[model samples]
Target: MNTGRDEDALRWDGDDDPTLDVGTRTAGADPTPDASGHDAASGEDAPPLALPDGFTAVGKDSDTVGHIEADGTVVMPGDKAPLSSPMLITLGILAGVYLLFTIGWIVGGLRLQGTAQFLVSPVGYQVALWLAVAAPALWFVTAYALTRSSKSWVRIVWLLAGLVVLVPWPFIMVGAVGTVAR
Candidate 1:
């Protein structure tokens, strides 16, 4: 072991290294047999790869660490992990609500075609109508993606607020019932 080095320089204390050659053999010296009667210098008998000083081999079975799912999903340490059951249910409900909003938009847009004339052009009205319908779904997806690391309550509050705020106005007004003649 080289000594009298700078304090800041990186050093490896191999004196206590279990992987170090146990015999008093010099580097580049001819290989010798170990106490177990196996050739010490031979790669076949040695632990798969040399471990750092003071570390013991955990064996090949220990390689499969962390959370591994049967579906081939591997969740490493510090990973985001999968959503909980309640969260999954909430997301499903939100998707259903968004689908309903889209249906409502289509129904209302068709029903109001003759009654409510587009201030701009027919194409503009269609674009606006479709965009309005898609907005809630887009918002939900965006919010879900953005708030992935946030608390469950925070995500729920944000999505619920969006649900209330992004209600399709045309659907509420005209709807599938069509114009009411009073």
Candidate 2:
């Protein structure tokens, strides 16, 4: 009996909360404005949602798939979509292979050039030929790498810009030294 009496007293104290209302009892049931739970924002009276009344939904082409109201942004036909993973990977692999091949060629040419005259079987002409051919091709390969590396395009661009500064700087110094020698 005493336990039940204490529980009743606590419940009695809760009745005086001025902020409590009927809306709080069934807040999430629905938005029906009626005698039981009426809403002031009736159909015609409520602010209109910003959706357009009529529009068309388009897929990758002129073909229409569905209707859209003012609500949605549409993707027009033939938009340059993101490249697929296979394409990106293929390009990256090609870039890597080309880079490796160019590096090998440069190194090989240097080795051949250095040992050409001293070796028992003379290789000067062959080495010089390879160095001349590979050295110019390396520039083309580097240009291709810069173009193909979409993932690192920004980095490649900055690297190339730096290379522009570096490649000519040494030549300038070398030319100056030659002039001084003359």
In model 2, pairs of residues that clash are 33-38, 33-39, 34-38, 52-70
> In candidate 1, which residue ranges exceed 4 Å CA deviation?
1-76, 177-182
Question: Mind giving the per-residue lDDT tens digits that candidate 2 earns over 48-159?
Answer: 2222345443444224232233436433232234456775675466555445545544544445454555753456567554554454346546655665534555545644
RMSD of each predicted structure: 15.3, 18.3
Tens digit of lDDT per residue, candidate 1, span 108-154? Answer: 77777665664567787778777877887888888888898898888
- The C-alpha TM-scores of every prediction are 0.55, 0.28
Please give me the total number of clashing residue pairs in predicted model 2: 4
